[model samples]
Target chain A: MDVSEQIHAELKKCGVRLAASLPDDWVAPLIRRLDADNDIRHVPVGRESEAVMVASGAFFGGVRSVAVIGNTGLLTCTGELATLNLRHQIPVFCIVSMRGSIDDHQIYQEVQGRRTIPVLQAYDFPYRVIDRPEEIGCIPDAYQWCRLQKRPFILFLTRALLKGRRWS
Target chain B: MIAKEAIRVLAAHRGDAIAVCALGVAANEWWDATKAEDCFQMHGAMGFAASFALGLALSLPNVNIWIINSDGSLCMNPGCLLTEAAQAPRNLKHFVIDNQVYQTVGAVPMVNAGRTDYAGLARAAGIASTHTIDNVPEMEKQLPRLIAGPGPTFVVLRVEPDPSHINTPPVTYEGPEMKYRFGRALEKRFGISVFNSSGY
Candidate 1:
């Protein structure tokens, strides 16, 4: 199976009934996979913060959820994540693209590569990067861990995991 | 109309609807009016309560959801309207308390000074049923229909700034306690489990 399919299966195993996303190139396939699923409710939001807030809301309704977005988008929503999820102690699982990695030659993503982990660390938000398809299975455990942590947790998909394909 | 009075009116007709309130005045007023555990009154995240409510509405599908968003909060993220519009959950109702100022912080004037047409913005964002009410009587008159109608509805309640309630305290519970209270309330109300066996 493809990495996207593997990731989708893991999300299902994690009991994610809802997914809110604003896609970047790397996470787009997974977003499409979630969008096509009938059982999992997929919400396409205007901004990354909306996805984070939406997932936070789903927790109150007894639904497990995930927010999917790009690394840059992840930076945009940190304040919301800190204030809403951290302050309220609501756990939201986010799947993000690990932009600006060594393989990522995009100039726009360079700042994110160096700064993202430090930002998450400063906020005490937990995160793990999945660079290979085999690590996708860890999502269920991460999801549960986020729930236990009662805060925002991020599962980042690295360039290596989503590479080997050409979009243009 | 006063915010408390408007909230009281909304609470009276609330029925089974679950509410998510934005931080500050909207949340504080709702807590004061209803003292409801089912409602999640946000202490932070000033702008995204609308998105939060939409998520809950989409997830539950059977439960009614209301968002009490204030003008200052709405201005912080007006793009939420487009997201709400796109989902168009029939169970969600959006309300904005337009006091023309940040009520919690000593009545500082809002970014656009309350001249921004929020209902018009909602309508423009594709929410077909949008209403703006400026009085308690009008809210009372229209709330029954608003509650009964299929939603993704938007309502703007325009009220005068009340300096007296500016420093009103927030709800009793906050942080994790507030989280469990709201979640457990929903679980009890709907017979669903928000926490796992070990009690998250």
Candidate 2:
């Protein structure tokens, strides 16, 4: 299976029924997959924090869920991450499309990309990097860790994962 | 009646109804008058009053659920109305205290300030039973009927901004802890597992 299919299978196995996201170039394929899957309800939110809160509510309502956003979006959601997710132990499974890091072509993402790990660390959140399609399996394992810990977890996706990928 | 008066009316008619107030001075006034146990104040979160109230209404389906929200906050998550309407809970009543300003955040004027109509928005979102009250006396007279009349009601309260005096101290409970406590209470009361393994 490709990366999107692999991620979709893992989320399905983990019983993630509700998913929310902000538009991002790197995760467009994953978002499309979530949309096409009838079992998964996809909510497109205006802001990253709103997505987090919605995911939090869905989780509270006994539904397994995830929120997908770009690394820059994570910076905007710090207050939410700190108060709502971390302080409240809301297990937020975030798939962050890495941008603006070392060897990144996009200059606009550089600042946020560099700060992503430090921000997650500051909030005491555990994160893993996924540089290739094969690493998609680790997402379910990361989600399990988040469920066990009752905290937010991050899966950082580098450009390498989306490179030369076809939608189908 | 004004938003404060409506709250007072609700408090007077309290019969297993739990009030969830969003963060602001208007909410603070009502919060001050009522017991903390009966109120769930959204401290840090800006626009979650309706969502929180929805949770409470669903979890405690037997109890009457009321949300004291602001126009500014309500707009932040207009999708919440769709969610509420979709769920179609018979016991949920949302009261939007339409002050038209982000009162907590330096009184910034909300989008489409005077032009926006919350009642219309609610109706458009399929919350057919909605009411708008302009003054204290109107609210005092009409609130009872609004509360008694229907399922999933929305009230747009037009009131003057009373320089928000709801004194919320700096210290507050963590969201997780509150969620855990709420979940446990809900589980104990309703026998439903709302939270996952970590207990919210």
Docking class for candidate 1: high
Candidate 2 stretches with Cα past 4 Å from truth are A101-104, A164-168, B10-20, B26-40, B48-67, B75-93, B100-116, B120-131, B136-154, B163-176, B196-200
- Give RMSD to native, each candidate: 2.0, 4.6
Residue pairs with backbone overlap in model 1: none
lDDT of each: 0.90, 0.73
Off by over 4 Å in 1: A165-168
On the 0 to 100 scale, the lDDT of residue A138 in model 1 is: 91
- Cα deviation at B118, candidate 2, in Å, is 3.9
lDDT value for model 1: 0.90
Q: Which candidate tops lDDT?
A: 1
**Model 2 chain B: lowest-lDDT 10 consecutive positions:** B164-173
lDDT by residue (A26-123, candidate 1, tens digit) is 89999999999999999999889999999988988889999999999999999999988999889999999999887799999999999999999999
Tens-place lDDT per residue, model 2, A27-132, is 8898999989988777776667766666765664566788888888877877767765666676778888887756577778778877778878888988898876
Per TM-score, the best of the predicted structures is 1
Error of 1 at B49 (Å): 0.9
